[model samples]
Target: METNLLFLWGTPRSMSTAFLRMMLERGDHEVFHEPFSSIVVQGRTVVGDHTVTSHDKLLRLLEERARDHRVFVKETTEYDYLSTGGDRIPYAGRHTFIIRNPRSVIPSHYAMNPAMACEEIGYGNQVEMARRVLAATGERPFVLEAEDLLDDAEETVARYCRHVGIPFLPSALSWQPGDQKVWSRTSQWHRDAARSSSFTRSEATYEATVDSDRFLYDCYWHHRPYYHVLRKWARTTVAA
Candidate 1:
C-alpha cells in the first residue's frame, strides 16, 4: 500500500482542479480524480456526476490502486458535504484542504451553483467547512492557497513535499498539461474562473461576497495569523 493517500476536500472553484493537474504532473504517484466522492448536497438528490455509488467498494478499489505506490492522491472537493455533516473519512495518511479567498470564492461558487448563496446556508459555510475537516482529522494538513501556489509554483510543490514527508523533487515543477484527458466533471463556469481574467462585480455582487468575510474569518482562524504575516512580506517585496 501507498505510504500516503492524500484526500482533498473543498468546494468548487477552490483550485482543487489545478491541484489535480499538478499532482498528475508529478509523474510518480497515480492520482484518482474524484473517484469515490459523489456530489449529494441536500441528501435527497445528487448533483453533477455519479459513475459509482458504493463507498466501501470504491474504497477497496482505491486501496488496490495504492497497493504498490508511495503516494496516491484522491480529490473530491465536493466531499465538503460529508465533512460538514460530522462524518469520519476512513483512509490512511493525513487529510488536507485547498482554499481560496472567499471573496473570489463566493462569486465562483455561486456561479457554479447560485443555490449555494450565503443567505441560504449562511456566510460561514465556507470557513465552517475548513473547521470541520480540521476538527475531524485532528491534523493540520497543509493549507495551500491558490495565490501562493501561482506566485511560486516550485516553492509550493516543495512545501507539499515537506508537509507530506516525501522527498522533495524538482520534477513536480514542470508538468505537462495532460494530452489525452477526461472532461466529464469539469464545468464551463469553473473553466472561466480558472483563468486570470478579471470579474467586474456590481455593487450588489460585491456586497454579497464581501459581507461573508466575517464568517469566513471565524471558520478559519488557523489561517489568518500566517496569512497576514505572508501578506506583509508580499507587499514589501512587491513594492520594492
Candidate 2:
C-alpha cells in the first residue's frame, strides 16, 4: 500500500512535540519527528539504526519508508534553514500548521535561546507555507492553534484526524512520558515535553514582561499580525 503522509508543522513552543507524541502512540503510522532537524544537527539522517549524510540518499530512504507504511511527520518551520525545498515536500501529503500566541511563544522561546531570531520562532514561515500549500492544493491546509488544542485535546485532535483522513484512536490522545529516539534528545523543549503524558492548560502569562525585553518584544509584535492572519483561517470546531 502507498503510505499516506501527514505533515504536522508548527512554530517553536507550540506544543508540537506533545502532538507528535500523541501520533506516535497510535501505533498505526510510522512517525518521524523533525527528520530534517536531525540531519541539520547531526550532519546526517539516521535510517533505522544507520546514518546517511547524502541529501539525495536521505530522500530516497524516506520514499522507500513511505511506500510500505503510513507516515506521520512533525517538525517546526525553522527547518527552512536546511533548504528552500522543504515546502515542496508536503505537496504530496496532507499538511497542518500549528500556532501559538506570540505572547506565550516569544517568552518561552527567548528563555531557551536569547540569540534566537524572529524568523527562527517560525510564525512567518508557518503563514507562508500554508499559503504555498493552498496554492498548490486548491484547499487550505488545516490550521490548529496550540491554545485550542490544549483547551480540548480530544475534540481538537479528533477533528484534525478526520480532516487528515485518519482513524481517531483514543490512544492517540495520551502517551507514556519519556524521550523517544524519533526526536532530538538534546533539545530542552523536547525534554520538557517528554515529562508530560498529556496536555494541560498553562496559567503562565508574559505580556507584562514582553515590553521589557526589547528584542523579544519587537519579534512578538512583528509576528503577532501574521499569527492573527493564520488564526483567522484556523480550524477550531467541526463546523469550521
- Give the winner by lDDT: 2
Residue range 11-31, candidate 2, lDDT tens digits: 878889888888888998888
lDDT of 1: 0.49
Query: Where does candidate 1 stray beyond 4 Å?
Result: 39-51, 74-91, 117-138, 175-183, 187-240
Give the alpha-carbon lDDT of every model.
0.49, 0.76
lDDT of 2: 0.76
Q: How far is candidate 1 from the true structure (C-alpha RMSD, Å)?
A: 7.6
